[model samples]
Target: MKDDVDTIALVVVLVLFAAVTVLGFKAARWSRGSSLASLDEWGLGGRRFGTWVTWFLLGGDLYTAYTFIAVPAVLFASGAQGFFAVPYTIIVYPLVFLFLPRLWSVSHRRGYVTPADFVRGRFGSRALALAIALTGILATMPYIALQLVGIQAVFEVMGLGGSSNILVADAPLFLAFAILAAYTYSSGLRAPALIAFVKDALIYLVIAVAIIYIPTKLGGWTGIFDAAEKKLTALDGAAGNPADFSFAGVGQAWPYATLALGSAMALFMYPHAITAVLSSKNRSVPRRNAAILPAYSFLLALLALLGFMAIAVGVNPVGLNGKPNAQLSIPLLFETMFPSWFAGVAFAAVAIGALVPAAIMSIAAANLWSRNVYKAFLRPGASHADEAKQSKVVSLLVKFGALLFVLGLDKSYAINLQLLGGIWILQTFPAIVFGLYTRWFHRWALFAGWAVGMIYGTWTAYNIPNPASGAQHFGGSTAAIPLLGEKGYVAFTAWVLNVVVTVVLTLVFRAFKVAEGHDETSPDDYHADAGEPGVRDVATPGAAGKAGAAAEA
Candidate 1:
């Protein structure tokens, strides 16, 4: 359907966008630090966020605009399978509860700004740390692009994407991204941390209203489900296979279960998630937030039901190229179901949601590059201020790279790239997560395993075709295991191979007396907390020497 410009909704969205932009610029002064010259201040919000701020920041970080858009889109396109996100998110907090506090403690004690920083300090291998850092940047760039896709979906629904001229069509998207990139450069992580407050408020309010109002208008959940069932069951795939609307069939259960498990493991492995965890003021903040974050999972489950609601209302959204676009289902649903002003508010929630995670991801990616790649490889003695400057500049480039993904590539291709990113990132788990608890895996063996897993995952993902999208490769996340008869999430399968290779190689290399690099961290460092004795001096050599002198005095 061709949509005219939603002038009222556009005005409301612009107003909210302006308000958030103001907050983003002023956030440099929020909880004002001594200087914004250090990565500790710029990349991490000075590591002083308490329970409430951490809650919202982490929420804004993980439950991204993509989650607000794609989860429901998958449900709208393919029923029940899309709900794998719900279980994945539900299982994630418990997994996070197990390890994140330890990560936060070690990072805080040692002044590690990125996961690669912790990996380098733990294993003493720049090569291994470089792998983790590069994978993070690779995985995150497409994700940030997905955020732009989220914002674009809203814009397209508001009729900003129907222009005959390309520049005119994408002007709003470029402008929004430019503003986000500017504030993030000037204010750093604080910009996103501050904007997360308004983002979450708008999100919760929109979701609350959507669940209540849309169901009643559609005659409740029963009616919505029936309509969806009727519509989906009648629709056949290109191969003429009837769609599975109720739940995963016998063939799909493994993929569903494994996708959830793999995603749960990979969630915390992402740099942005760790950035949020590391920014917390205390160790207990993450533990408490882990318990509380599942509340958003409940909201996500409710949001997933909006797919059925859209089907019931017969909402069909067209993309910029005038093709069928499931990503616009929720945005179009609100446009049809709600008044103009309320729809504007819903669109703003998603657009602002994009901003928070995009800022966080770009910052995380920049920190990884600056700390691991730039500092370790390019300049060994770069100062803290130098690191911060590199990150700010790189953050802008990262956003532009993502902008290219949105402008140059197909939207579904971007989505598939993000799925591929999950596959690639999960390959880092053995190096980062397992290394956290034990250093038994030889550094060389871990690197080999990562290389093997990455190659296998990419090769496997490249062969799986999506008949619906008419793509011959990289179409899905699940594939048949080599020996096992059942299909499973390719990441989990690849990870299993990764562990097997690591274990076998570790035994052989250790028996041969292969040199494992020195471990720079102590056991006690893993349990260190904020306000601990000597914690303040760990990051500063001068402070440490002065404190030693004071002790002698």
Candidate 2:
């Protein structure tokens, strides 16, 4: 539980950071398209990435710094409930396998960069697309802020110094984020797409080594679980409490299960997630990646073991102002066990892992702003180059904003922003997801749903109280809604209420023959592929076939 990073570890960390910075600059050349002028290329990496690249890109973007630190941290603090991340990640792939291909096909054929692009095309309403885009960008900001939180955790572990010197604790963080902002601005999605390989490799190496070596240090798998159970059981505070405490509580399996499901539903709605999906060369790439990517789930299962190891090794959270720093469990475990050099690599991996997703998220958010807000309202006739330029500038600003979040904001508050993101973005499901299949709901009704859901979700989240933290409305997802009268339900519960209102209002509006927006897209658009004739806006079947055959022959 002390600052133990060695000089050798520091050198290795420096080397890896240098390698990633170089890779960021080099990414601009990896799959250079005919031009970087258009959103199709700049915003989406030319929309030509193969299945392999996309697998890594989407995997890297989705399984973020929080996924690396927070899941294990939760497990170390709680128990089996933290394992919900594993099942949720697993469950998400099947849903992606089924839905994302259709989304990909439609987006590809429509020249859509953001999901809002498709929403506008399908709904024939600028306001609807703007709403979806706004939701995406807003949801993604806090999520990006949490990525910085991951990097900060890594710095706290690696620097291993007192926070008395603000400059010492924060100087390295500023430098790292500055490098990330520059590269993402210069290279766009290419930076993160290329660096994901290193990020993932380091993560696998650290997790694999920890799984084999750390468990041996604690005896074995049996000993590790036993020690964890014993430690948690010693904390029993109630007559009916379970023998081993989980993160949430005893006898509340449904809340965790529902939380997992709700999280999966909202995951794809995040602008960053959708941006990665839209960048694929073909629809099948996303489907194939979904099927194969669960291999990370296997790794996540190993990462969760770090939590139990923390318990077995008796790595108690250090007292910072008399509060346990639950986030330090993994870092403490690694420092205590690994040699200097390997621990350094582990620290660098987490720090660099934060950058990869953070860059992509900023780009995604910036694209939403340029395309849905700037182009939609301000510059109706803006060129692709103009949109790309605007996005690059916004991406830089986003990183700076994340820097402020890390420097000034509480880490728990940042995490609550992420939960709020989930709740707010989930409100768009009725618009984005259902809009993909049908236009039965009136556009105004969808707008009403989004507005109501956003207000209710934010208000509810704002009012919840945490007795432990003395914070109002946003401690952690563990807090509940009084109206729901259910435990373990938080943001997800807010989403459910949002959906019910959406459905009921849609029915009422439909019965009255309200003026729903035009559906410019047809059902056939969802099935169109790159090789299909007239796939993009310029072609129909006859013209599309000629183009494909020309390219082939």
Candidate 3:
């Protein structure tokens, strides 16, 4: 994968990188509000984004560099298992459609900045909120690292990195991460919000071209799939395992279905996903986006096909270690298949795609730490300005933390951790989503459930060895279901236990007459909309019944 640097592509990449750096800074004043010294403004884009802005924001940031690099790489590596991402993206919207508007409305009316904020309000449990926040930040770290891994893949293809020294190999990525930290520090959520527009356009443009033009060279979709299938079946036959390379076979079906289902449940639970949702101008904005956001699904399906195209084109990329690296599949595919300048544009798209989501993810994680961890424990009386300052600083640290994961661990480790993160995050669904409609589950019970789920999920993931590398733990996302003797997503299995524990604990707590704590929200809060009379800037937390406070005041 290392060669003479494509001078033309390198220049294009740097030029585009500099261009987005400017946008990230200019976004600070794009939609001027009273100030940017608070979580509402600094971390959630002042909650002023309308439908189209929200659309681009979610579109670019949500799909992420992982979608661009990892999904295709997985397809290139294993065939059908990677296609799980496609159906999961489709399944996620309808699941979100049912509950996200309710979340938006409640958060819009109540000044909630994170999912943990909602949990705190609904359950009146600081411990539960802390668990939710910690899980989000923990789950988010590897996901962010994967984005850097995307940029690293692009750099490797361009011959910018492939050194024996860690610092030398990662210097270009370090520069990209530094620029991202700077803009996010200065502009906060606005940085990613503005940059997302360019990211979306470039990704669509690059994919549109690659799908049409590259397939023509490879003799079209028929040849691509035929080549992919032939290669996959031959490998499976060699191993004495007959998986249908064209589709997930009988043995693979349960894991595929559960992966899709569990992943769909976990997608919106990430702090970054909630940050985008909470940034919308109003409740209607989220609902509208939910219905329309699936447009990205069509794009995702097309993106996954690039994997087969990689297989068809006979792409065989090696990593800096000179080992066959499936993660390099797409980037090297572009480098090999396209002209230098066009390949440069494609690389820029992948690199910028990583930046947008990485910024958002860092912001989301920092906000979680500030609101739930810092303010909740260390400085309970902190001001909005103080919280904003803390989050700005923490966001920088979070990116570096991701850099640590990228530099220190395996590339596949980031991917597996993301899957594990999904398992961890799904545990919060019962606490946050259920509390939206009813307070039937006691707060302590929810906390206990989360603990059980987190511990169980982590243990199960730790035991599933990677068959290829022979790593003894965290190798894959799936495990066997209880009593079923079949593999399903560990996250879903953990979630099932999480719910059962929560239900049983709730009954026991009720029987023993344990206090249910307090609920700050009334029924109206979940259905309230923007500009409703006396709706305070719900992005900021204050007062006993702040949800009903007037914005104009």
Number of the top-ranking candidate, with lDDT as the measure: 3
What is the lDDT, from 0 to 100, of the residue 56 in candidate 1?
88
The lDDT of each candidate is: 0.85, 0.76, 0.86
Candidate 1: list runs displaced more than 4 Å. 236-239, 242-246, 413-417, 537-553
Write one digit per residue (lDDT tens) for candidate 3, span 19-137. Answer: 99999998777664667888988998778778888888888777987789888888888887888888898999888888888898888778889999999999899999999999998
lDDT of 1 by residue, 84-183 (tens): 9899999998888989989988888888999999888998898999999999998888789889889988999998877779888888889888999999
Evaluation by TM-score, superior candidate among 1 and 2: 1
**lDDT of prediction 2:** 0.76
Which should have the higher TM-score, number 2 or number 3? Answer: 3
Query: Across residues 405-424, which tens digit of lDDT does each residue of candidate 2 receive?
Result: 55654453334546667877
Every model's TM-score: 0.95, 0.92, 0.95
In the predicted model 3, the residue pairs found to clash are: 111-538, 534-549
- Order of models, best TM-score first: 3, 1, 2
